[model samples]
Target: MARKIPFFIQIILIPLLIAAILLVELKHPFPKFRLAALVLVFALIVDVAILARGKTRNLMVVLASLVFGLSLAEGAAGAITPRSVVKIDRGWSVRQPIMGWGPEKAGTYHAQMIDPSDNSIIYETNYTFDSDLLRHTVSADSGPAIVFFGDSFTFGDGVKNEETLPQDFADLTGGKQHVLNLALTGYSPQQFLHEMETSRFDKVIGPDPKLFVFLTAAWHAERTSCKAYWTAHAPLYALEDGRVVFKGDCNEGASLWWREWLGNSALYSYLIEPWRHKVKHNDVELYVSVLEAAVKMAKEKYGAPTIIPYLRMPKEYLQGTGFTNDSIMQRLSDSGAIVIDASLQKEEAAGAQISIRIDGHPTPYANRVRAAQIKAAIDEKLPGVLLADAK
Candidate 1:
């Protein structure tokens, strides 16, 4: 005798699951994901109308097997998986009229990094932003403005308010150059290009910049390619007739369901994430084009040399990942970028520890090392600016 399907499990529970999936699709609709979601919903509907009426016992067996299997898998994975609870200061970002998300607000926030192993707080500091949404530079803005651009490494993610690269550079040079830090956390080179393309360039920066510095990372390849999930709302670019052109934001037709669903899952993070990261969207050619375009524009518009700190090849990236792209450094150099050696030597790395324990982000001492190298690059690449500042 076949057992009847339970009203609660099939009629209520399965429908609820379908509803949740539909909601996610509505929120972040990707074409492929929507088709798959619709197919899954159809299967659930079939089970309710057809399978539930006839093969009740078999359906029950399958449901029970999936539930039991997933429970054991999730539990086993959770035991070994690194997890941490985060309490962030809200209202840090303001939504742009376009798809982009803007800067951190001008306020102080209690920021801390936690050890996932023992749930201990590694360090706590206040992150303070200025009226322009930049981290407060250690020195006042007065001299010829030297602008720094990149992600959090340039923004000093886990360091003190005054321990950033721009601040360290200002202090290293006796505050001769007025530092303008325009880097935001989770930003890519795309944002830098976007800034150069828009009117926000003149509005955000007062007067002409003395120089432009970009801290490129290996992970930035994924960021500019729109492979990183955090870049879903970031500006997107494409090459047209060997010129970089703005397309749209990353959320347009982006397939981010895995990141939305299983990103935090240890099993998924360890297994599937690597598989997906193997192939990039448009690859580094597009990346270099965007960079080259920004460089050309900066030279054409502001007559300032764009300095790209050579970071891809010499050592493992700040996040402990190696860049497999061979021509990344050479390409930038060929594109007329001032690529400098920012990688720390063994003795310097020993004294300065390349990364913090919380994540593989650069330490304060490491920033100072890079800043010193950058200042040297500035002296060599933009000697005119150096002479002007010295005058």
Candidate 2:
């Protein structure tokens, strides 16, 4: 009976073992760690069912015990994890098949980030969007437009209407520039590319857009790759024969089942999620390729110079990638983009501050500083527009 038990156990485990083996190989571009990971998984699966030695099944028993123990740990971690309370009124933003999450509807909605431990409100602010679903522009009907593209930093995550970067830029330029801020929270370069490809600009953007600017950050590299958990629905692009081409949504990868499942494990959250979302380096070439396409389209479609900001990759994201941040900037320059300099990007840590102590987003003052730099860049490129052109 005891001998038969091992056989039956092996039979039951075989299918899962096979599935896990297959999953380990799915869409994993990082070849350096593949071998070690395969070895570890194989040993675990083998110990659980392959081994049927003499008296004591100590090693096998230990491995089986860990499987259950880790599961329990995962459940516990998930239970205790602090979840912020977020409340948004109706028609805030709609779901877009291409952009994953589309523009915010024109209305005022309030948001806050509360500390779950003490149930304290960290910060509270209201957001107002235009009929075109953009955040804020001095006057969308006025002057030559300067379009902005970026994530929360450019979107002014926690700031109010008058304090956003685009708003600040308009105020600084005497409201002469019709700043079209297309920035949104959780946006990646793929959204930018998709919007341009679909000609969303022709219908929505104000007439005669003078220049486009993309605010730089280290995380843009990861987000653009569509490997992040929030990006499953994002329009995915791949490099086909050295050209970046759209290949539908990222969810089309049936092989990426493992990332979806394993990513939910709170044990994985502690052991891997932080580095998983951002800690490890992802495919830079694919990301930069998408960005390259955006840059070209900006010029070809709008006939305007797109100024991209350049920031060094934080040292933590330096591992597991062949190219450096400088290489990313080089890719932009090679694509006919002239300037991605210090005037637009601030590497100084002190320059960025937490907004109202709510989160890591830039404060209103920080946005003002960044806006001044962008205005300076625009003045140099466009020249005559800054003659105190207040609307």
The sequence of per-residue lDDT tens digits that candidate 1 reaches over residues 126-204 is: 7788887778886545755788888888988888878888889878777666778888788878888888777465665
Question: How far does residue 108 in candidate 1 sit from its true spot (Å)?
Answer: 1.1
TM-score for each candidate, following the candidate numbering: 0.79, 0.74
- Best TM-score among the predictions, by candidate number: 1
- Report clash pairs, candidate 1: none
For residues 1-391, write the lDDT of model 2, one tens digit per residue: 3645456666667676566555665545442223433444555555554556643566666666665566466556656765436555556656666577765457787877776767787667887887887885665466667788888878877778888888888788776557778988888788888888987656666556777888775567667676576676778888888888888877755645666656545566566666656533346767777888989988888887788866565655756676767777887889876555542244345555534564767778778877777777666765754545452
TM-score of 1: 0.79
Where model 1 places Cα greater than 4 Å from the true spot, the runs are 1-51, 55-79, 85-87, 93-99, 253-267, 279-282, 313-326, 348-351, 387-391
Q: How accurate is candidate 2 locally (lDDT)?
A: 0.69
